[model samples]
Target chain A: MDRDQANYLFNVMRLDQGASVTLFNGRDGAWRAEVAERGKRGGALQVAEQTAPQRNPPDLWLLFAPIKKARTDFIVEKAAEMGASRILPVQTEFTNSERIRQDRLQAHAIEAAEQCGGTFVPEVADLARLDRLLSDWPEERQLMFCDEALFDRPSPLTNGDATSSGTGTPWAILIGPEGGFSDAERSRLHALPFAHPVSLGPRILRADTAAVAAMTLWQDRLGDWTAPNSDPVR
Target chain B: MDRDQANYLFNVMRLDQGASVTLFNGRDGAWRAEVAERGKRGGALQVAEQTAPQRNPPDLWLLFAPIKKARTDFIVEKAAEMGASRILPVQTEFTNSERIRQDRLQAHAIEAAEQCGGTFVPEVADLARLDRLLSDWPEERQLMFCDEALFDRPSPLTNGDATSSGTGTPWAILIGPEGGFSDAERSRLHALPFAHPVSLGPRILRADTAAVAAMTLWQDRLGDWTAPNSDPVR
Candidate 1:
């Protein structure tokens, strides 16, 4: 975070010099900061001692099919804010893009990280083929698949025993595109022993809404649901 | 509802005459529609008898402090898709907008209704003062207030009693703006007996995220969670 960056943030917030702000290095934890030196063009930040320790993020991956640009950015940003460990863009049969602007999407993720006070920026992987991604999948990791096809099944959250893995193995959520998954994709997903097809209720959800709902459900079931009295930011 | 309207929809969808589309009148439920005739500019639709009866919408109301124009539209759209019966915009101590473009927002809600195959469009209410809104609040309606003040409380979905008032009653979820609620607003919210101070979990969620999360929680607990096995447009 440089002076120009500080100024940009301050301008967005309409804050003046000497105003206290928080900063996190994703390694050293959060810090209490203030406008150290103000100038016409920019200002510097005075980072004080750490306010919160480096907390570990949950091993949650958000695997979603790429939609439109704005929506893709939205999914990435929300995924970061929701504490996803990795954001993977899977190219499905219905995925619209062959040429994704990875840098722009990555920048949006970074900005979301900066705004939401996340210590770790989710690793945004380049677009990968869904078939290849599934074929070489890590068997140990649990897949909480948000299957549009399974509206009758109860929410994955309700099945407490399903998430009882003692090792706390990594978990990921898969959300399909507007047209949803082809029969082949669904069949492959169903065949996987580790894949859990969870219902987001009866009404069809847009891909973006499904992503948020699935994250909320998972957080309630296994992630840190409780908030600390005071924010741990450095 | 008529031929001209059918043509407009067809134009947007790039459909030719006799192309099938879905129509829902809210009262008679949804219907199977087709472009019966196409003119030089517009087209006509022939709507068959109801396909699905008018399903009941939830009593949930989404009351949010409005943000940017486009995002506000997005909120209204998502709220409609998520099954809110009404959408209210309130002005808080920190609320930025004193005047809201009601008709434009209403249009957005209508379009959302059309897109999601929802028969009923959520009512978008005019801007109201937060204090006054609370003062005149209905006693029977439970307020799931998303309280930033209580960082310790788990997310509303996790903290809420799933069995409480299984009977569906009028309820509303309150979301603050980017700056969040002022101390005065927080105190007023805390003092209300009808207000249930709830969290959206450990990670700080943006206003839009909170809205979606709250709706999902309510829908999971009390609203219709049945998967739409039959066509949504009845």
Candidate 2:
């Protein structure tokens, strides 16, 4: 253990030898560990039995145009808490921030996982141009394009499992920036067969709010929403 | 117009006497008004044509127990944006904050409406005891009770309009505090006929996320999600 971690586990938390603690290794599952050694600057935890099996979110990826810093962080945190498998920051024509701190965002995802007791932490990808992403889009993965132009329509996305081939295909949801999608980009997305346009509701949600609401709709309709309980959206 | 309004319009925004602007009064519609008189601390506007009708969200109310300061603010803002007609903060057994600034939360609702370009601003009600609110609960209105204990269950709520009495019945969504509902409270709620317990999936969504998620679900099933686009969820 690092010095700060040692202090937290030993000095601050006041743990004695053989104290039990839970730990996750960012892959599948969590484990119960025991305090094996205690020191001023270091400590060791002995791995015990598994507490939770590896649980991951659906094959879902959130692709959004970065907005303000705090809201951007909020999107990542909420996405992580709401059960997104991966996070991607896409740069669109109307995207405000040219760059994002991938490390910091990853940290936020981890924090959200720990705070929400989620077993998995989504990987936050570095910023990528939207056009480039479209060109390199994976063939079988379906896209839920949350189009601003379709703001007031009833969502047509009813069942996620309806499209299930039983092979566990992946899905992605795209949220545009505040200024909205450029004309050219909207046309391009609309033309793609894999992209399915859907409305969130009748209110104009801010980018961050839209991200949460969109995920809710997607999860409610087609994701693991009706599955026997395995994940927590809190 | 108030002093701040006048200053914002005449000085900060640098609008002249004839500039055009839009206005919304909490009631029903928005109108385009021309600046008739510009003063240092105030200004006058001549009502022009109606830009949009006074479109209200479906009959929906969001009742939640308050959490931290920022997250409480988030619930109000999101409720307003997501088209809840009323926001009520309830005092549950586990609720931390005993009191809430109704005015500040009201302001947040108004700000959210203006930013999202909604015609109606949801009223932020003062904190009320949960039991009292439940006792006085309207007979016809249904309540979508979000239970943490059912976190892993598939939602039983499917269609909101399925129970239509052709009377435009009202509905409300309830979210518990961070620590979740007391056992007694949950049993009381589950026993009520008007109260329907629904899961927001297995993930333990924070209270704020639950509020938004519950609203989205209700809107999708029983509310106005299917009405021709009149509001925007963003």
Candidate 3:
């Protein structure tokens, strides 16, 4: 344990020298560890044993352009809690923020996992150009692209055609920025074979709300909400 | 229009005396109103012709215990955006907040409607005790009670028994506080004939996330998400 963790365990949490606490490194399963040495500056922990085996979320990735700082953090935290296997910050044509703090976002993901009783912590990728990411898009993975202008249009999500997103397929959900995608970007995405454009609902949702709504819809139809106990990803 | 609104248009929005703006008061449809007078302290608006017909949301009522101030505001805003006809701040035994600012929360709902292009603004009901509210519960209105402890149990929602929630029936979604409903509250609710207890998912969601998830799930199966265009409530 480092200085900050020691301070948390000793000063904040007020744990004694032999107090047991659970720990997880995202790779190993959650472990029951005991405080060996507690000090004001630093501390030591002795790993006891595994308390729970690792439970990974589905092979789902969430891609979105970074917006305001607080909302961006909200998206990452909710994505982690909602079972996104990966979080990617894409730089779109109309993306407002020019830069993002990848480390801070990753920390938010970890904190979300810790708070939500999730064993898996989704990887938060550094900001990347949307065009470049699309260029190297995986042929096997399907992308659930949320389009704002298609609000009233019929979508496979509401229609029975959502079965096209068959089971056991790797999937990703892309949410655009507050300003939404440019026309050129929209056309290119529409032309892509693997992009399944969908609408959240009839009303316009804020960017953050759109992300959550899209994830909830996808999970309901194609993700693990249908069968959480026998989740294929788990 | 009132003086404060005139001042806002003139000072904050910089709208001229003849500028036009869309207005909706949950009764009349969205109307194109003209700024008749502009002043530093007050202003007047002339009611013009209607722009769009009133589009009321479904007969979905969202009942949630007030949480932290910001999150409570968030719940109200999201309920408005996601199409709730009524928002109720219930007082459960385990509810943390002793009181709620009904006006502030109602204002948040109005702001959400303004931002989300919603023609109908949901009515935020005053805080009432859960038992008192249940005592006068509508017999025909089905309640989709979201119980956190019933996470892995077989629910009508997942078991295809949601047919119990007949079509064209009024519905309400109840989300408890951070600590969840007390055992007595759960028992009382379970004994109610109109209450259909449902689970959001396998994971334990935060109160806010649970509220949204429950709404999405209910809207998907029993609410308007099935047929958005010909939505019965709308």
Candidate 4:
């Protein structure tokens, strides 16, 4: 990809000739490139070698019931920046909106990746039925369900330890819709052997805020907690 | 506050008389109200208390560097719903907008309180300089400064032992603006005895996302995580 990609450079950022911009090809990693030529309709850039390699993203999945358009977009963008491996929008009994523009959401994820300097963009899956999703759930992966109605319980961290001391296994964070999960849905989730129902504390969080909070908890427990201890080659 | 005072309901929600709405007095607690009277110009409500005080909020403060208009509103709203006792806008070296319309942000906090069934409205403080805030920092308070540039070290939570926990003492979560904290500001924060510099993790979270994340971490370790365990009287 070069500066002639008018959509990203000219249209989005409105860069001119000799302007330095960062580019990432996912596979080729991120690059520091300069605009070599500019034209009325398009431009060209000189590509440089990689600045950072495509590294490992946390094995985190954010499964949330879709909400309003703008808030849904906000959730997707934050999920990408928070290093989720995949984003799944599920249709629960209380999900208000059934239709979602997958392409537009995917675009938001891409933009979030570009802004946050992430080489791997989280894949936004097509909306799936919540019941079907539960039926087909994998046995190996544990889920940290953010259950607001269960206000009288301690939020079980992914490590199954209250002390926040362990990195147990790969995990996913689940957030319900605006109206919250129906009792039947809650019971079904509670019955799942792999599901760990956790409270986002006593206060009810908006769906978007729940997503961020749940991710933060999981990251604190299981994700990359340390800065690179050694000196970098650069 | 009456039903007529809600601009979103009168103009956006378009609620009519006899419509059931939730009301909160910040001190008296949450109540279920019905719009008893309505006119072209205004409306009134008759409120009946339902659920008694459910959760005790933590004495946590959220001091964030304000960003754009919409996002700043979002921060205030989310902070209130997430049970922040105080919201302070601090002017840092990298703060973009010096002037903040405090009334608009306070309204957002009120609406969020009303919507989330929160009885306590977070107090919004006047914008203060970062230096002044630090110099006047309460001795017993523990400040969790979310430092974005501290990439070479693990997050403070990773090193958080029981002794360093912010329990009992009043606490504050500080989030920087989009441009991040200046070098001098970072140094000052590092030198503060009461400040604990923490990272939200490897990925770069936006200011709003960071605020939510930091609050979640603090609440989990030190706030009301056990409040949700009692049976609902209703």
- Among all windows of 10 consecutive residues in model 3 chain A, the one with the lowest summed lDDT is A153-162
Model 1 chain B: lowest-lDDT 10 consecutive positions: B225-234
Residues B122-229 of candidate 1 have per-residue lDDT tens digits of: 779999988899888988888888876666665564444433755366788899988989988888888887777887776678888888888887777666664343
After TM-score superposition, what is the CA distance of residue B13 in candidate 4 from its true location, in Å?
7.1
Candidate numbers sorted by DockQ from highest down: 2, 4, 1, 3
Every model's DockQ, to 2 decimals?
Answer: 0.52, 0.66, 0.50, 0.64
Q: Is the docking of candidate 3 incorrect, acceptable, medium or high quality?
A: medium
User: Candidate 4 — which pairs collide?
Assistant: A151-B228, A151-B229, A152-B228, A152-B229, A153-B228, A153-B229, B26-B119
Question: Candidate 2's residue-wise lDDT over B143-219, tens digit each?
Answer: 88999787666654753533453225678889999999999999999899888888888778989888888888877
Q: Candidates' lDDT values, in order? A: 0.78, 0.84, 0.82, 0.80
Error of 4 at A182 (Å): 2.2
**Interface RMSD computed for candidate 1 is what?**
2.5
- Model 4 alpha-carbon miss at residue B210, Å: 0.7
Global lDDT of model 3: 0.82
Deviation from truth (RMSD, Å), model 1? 3.9
Residue B13 accuracy (lDDT) in model 1: 71
True contacts kept of 2: 0.68
Which digits, one per residue and each the tens of the lDDT, describe model 4 over residues B177-222? 8999999999999888878888887778889988988888877877
* Per-residue accuracy of model 3 over B116-202 as CA lDDT, tens digit each: 878888899999999999999988888889887776665436554456666577899999988889999999999998888876666
Off by over 4 Å in 1: A1-22, A33-46, A227-234, B1-17, B40-43, B155-162, B226-234
Model 1 C-alpha lDDT per residue in residues A1-234, reported as the tens digit of each score: 676575676666656778888787667778888878766666777887777776645778899998888888899988988878888999999888776777888878778877876667777899999899888988777888888777687656567645675224678899998889989899999888888888887666788988998887776666766533332222
**Residue lDDT tens for model 2, A1-234:** 667668888888989999998888677588999999877667899999999887777888999999999899999999998888899999999998998999999989988998888788999999999999999999988888888778566555754533452224578989999999999999999999788888877778899888888888877766777774434322
